[model samples]
Target: MRLCVEVFNGYRPPAHLRRLARPADAAEVVAQGLVGARRIAELRRPRRPGDRRPKHTTPVAVRRVYLCEPRSGAVEVAVALVTGERTWAMALRLELHQDTWCATTLRLI
Candidate 1:
């Protein structure tokens, strides 16, 4: 979950995290999201002194986490800011693989 916040806010993710998604999904996210996160290649400049909001002014935090299947090792996580124009929620899906939990999918809105 921490990795998700960092990735969305312009930080490099760990190698294993890069493989969290299927190849196609990872490719699309990297091409469309991570690249810009690194450099803001398409970010628009502010038109007035206070037109643009500072990046991540509010704190980012993990709101809640749950074990979807407690006895079986399926986990669900939710993270979002306490205050914002809208809820910036991120959901994660993880399953135990070979005795180790591995994230398989991520959704944000």
Candidate 2:
């Protein structure tokens, strides 16, 4: 989830997080998310002279984690991502494949 926010904030490249997802989903997320994230970063309001916030800070964090094991080798994770501007709810499905967990689906709720 931190990886997703980092990608959204332009702090990390989409490819860095893409490895977590299946190939097709990775490609789709990159095509849809990367470009939009860049634009969103650009549109963010710049800091003003009177603002006291640090120049660099972690603006994203996980507010809560909801995990469910539906079956062996499969789990669903729901989390709330809190950012400076707003909170985003996300759901991810992960499956154990080749002894490694890989994201099968991701949804923004």
Candidate 3:
């Protein structure tokens, strides 16, 4: 079976406080890192927080993804905070390709 890995990182707001910039930003971060059909599937999923209904009323900060191809066998992921309203964060997920199926790495970003 192919090896898989998943990694994630983000800021946790104060108790009861929501991070307005997490959802979109997280998506962008993951997008920048991964490629191929598997990467596309990951982007389609609502992996970011606050990405659900009740869209952001105010223009919350936009988030972005940065991918780095390292010499190691694993993938490197990074998040970029483009706006002042947001900060840098990132998460990663690895999937093992097996018999035309994919297995989750059981990682939370």
Candidate 4:
């Protein structure tokens, strides 16, 4: 989903998603960690010089997203990421808290 992409792209929650300018949910995921900033950097790294890889490597793309609502206030999301020729899978769990959705967990599948 766009929200997932936006969060991962910057490795931080968007302003609108923050509460009192504090994004505790996303901060938790980035801190105790899933898809840390280091990981994102690694994924976006360009092929090294003279590596014989294709010149036009594709940017990271969201290939697929599967959402599941197992309960009224919880959501589970499975996402597939495509970068160049490889694909990676990630999962995120969210819950509605105080009328706002908060990320409880995020990890690679």
Candidate 5:
């Protein structure tokens, strides 16, 4: 599948799992090494009435990791939002690993 479609579908292959050098790999290398503070805030915010806010609002970091197969033209990535705590936030990043690198599409689910 094309990188754009795979990312949307969130289908990741097994081999791509090993390439997860670190939680931040995709964020730094692929996602332009940048973190969207507003985006994080939106995700961390309480969506429902029963949802409780964190005791403290801490700044979390974003990282992206990927799995790719050249022959099959498939790529899968995981975007991790790391915080001081062990249980941070994370999103699935899927793409096509091509000769020309581009993060054309993303899904934060």
Candidate 6:
């Protein structure tokens, strides 16, 4: 989960994760980076002229995480994230590849 937050905050895979992926996965990683960056920008946009910019992001706390069948290597998580007075529901799907976990899905609203 920390890894997910780190990528979302920075919008790119760190060096180690980058090295572990196949070509297609790498492309998705880059695309996700763009999406994450854009989403955060929209979320943190200043509402008024004198307001301060948003701060460095903290990882959204996960309410629950569910593991699928043993060989499936898939995990699903539920997280509620607060944006101002609104609490958004977030769901994520991650898969294990070469013994390392990578996010295969991300959704927030």
- Candidates sorted by TM-score, descending order? 2, 4, 1, 6, 5, 3
Off by over 4 Å in 1: 13-16, 19-56, 82-85
Model 4 TM-score (2 dp): 0.63
Clashing pairs in 2: none
Q: Which regions of candidate 3 fall more than 4 Å away from where they truly are?
A: 1-56, 59-62, 71-73, 81-84, 99-109
> Taking the tens digit of each residue's C-alpha lDDT, what string does model 5 give over 1-109?
2332222223333223324324434444234222233345565678899999888765444544445544454454555545445333333433444453334334443
Q: For each candidate, what is the lDDT?
A: 0.53, 0.72, 0.31, 0.62, 0.41, 0.56
Better candidate by lDDT, 1 or 5: 1
Q: For candidate 6, write residues 1-109 as lDDT tens digits.
A: 5554555556445433344345457655545545654675566767898988767544434445555543578777666654354355655666788887666655554
Our model 2 lands, by Cα RMSD against the true structure, at 4.1
Per-prediction TM-score: 0.56, 0.70, 0.26, 0.63, 0.33, 0.55
Give the count of colliding residue pairs in each prediction.
Answer: 0, 0, 9, 0, 6, 0
Q: Each candidate: RMSD to true structure?
A: 5.0, 4.1, 15.0, 4.3, 12.2, 4.1
Give the per-residue lDDT of model 2 (tens digit) for 1-109: 7777677677788777678877867776564456646654644555676656546644656789999999999999998876666776767788888898887776655
- Give the distance in Å from residue 108's predicted Cα in candidate 6 to where it truly belongs: 3.6
Q: Which residue pairs in candidate 5 have backbone atoms (N, alpha carbon, C) closer than 3 angstroms, thus clashing?
A: 3-95, 3-96, 7-94, 16-67, 26-64, 27-64
Top-scoring candidate (lDDT): 2
Task: List pairs with backbone clashes in candidate 3.
Answer: 5-94, 6-93, 7-92, 8-91, 8-109, 9-90, 25-63, 28-65, 29-65
User: Candidate 1 lDDT, tens digit per residue, 1-109?
Assistant: 6666565555555343566655545554444335433333123335477797566444344565544554567777665633233345655667777676666666664
Which runs in model 5 stand beyond 4 Å of their true positions? 1-39, 43-57, 62-66, 84-98
* Superior by TM-score: candidate 4 or candidate 6: 4
Provide the global lDDT of candidate 3 against the true structure.
0.31
Candidate 2: list runs displaced more than 4 Å: 32-58
Tens digits of lDDT, candidate 4, 1-109: 4554555566354443333212656565654333433465565565686556445545557898899999999999998987667676777788888887777776654
* Backbone clashes (count) for model 3: 9
